[model samples]
Target: MRTTIGYTAESIGYVVGAQGLVSFASQTFFGTEWGWLHNVVDLPSTAYLGIVAVGLALIVGGVKMRKTPQPQKAA
Candidate 1:
């Protein structure tokens, strides 16, 4: 269960990070033209980088959780 949750978090993090990057790029380079995803859910300009940061944190945490050893069960 722990590993499963960790894997799920990692997957979600990748998606969030990718979305943030695209959104940030669009807004930064295209002069207020945000990514298509922004149309679905708009956020403040500051939140774009914040999203990327959160996504990276989640990825790191998930990787740590997935790598941790589980306790051995008694036979």
Candidate 2:
């Protein structure tokens, strides 16, 4: 159960991290060109939320891993 939760959290982190990277790149490279899309919706807040989500997911995954017991290795 813990392992499953850990994996899910890690996956969410990866998704959020990817979103942040993409938003940063687009904003840096395109500048006002991307503003058109922003005008259609709240891009800035969305980007911020994505970053925060990534951080939270990472924290959850780390906590789960630290608290869960490791399986024994075969000799």
In candidate 2, stretches whose alpha carbon ends up further than 4 angstroms from where it belongs are 32-67, 70-75
- Among residues 3 or more apart in sequence or in different chains, the pairs in candidate 2 whose N, CA or C atoms overlap within 3 Å are none
lDDT of 2 at 71: 82
Q: Write the per-residue lDDT of candidate 1 for residues 1-75, one digit (tens) a residue.
A: 889989999988888887888888877777565556698778766678888988898899899989999999999
The weakest ten consecutive residues by lDDT in model 1 span 28-37
Question: Top model by TM-score, which number?
Answer: 1
lDDT: which candidate is best? 1
lDDT of each: 0.83, 0.62
Location of the lowest summed lDDT over 10 successive residues in candidate 2: 32-41
Candidate 1: segments with Cα more than 4 A from true spot? 32-36
TM-score for each model: 0.82, 0.53
Residue 19 of model 2 has an lDDT of 58
lDDT of 2 at 25: 61
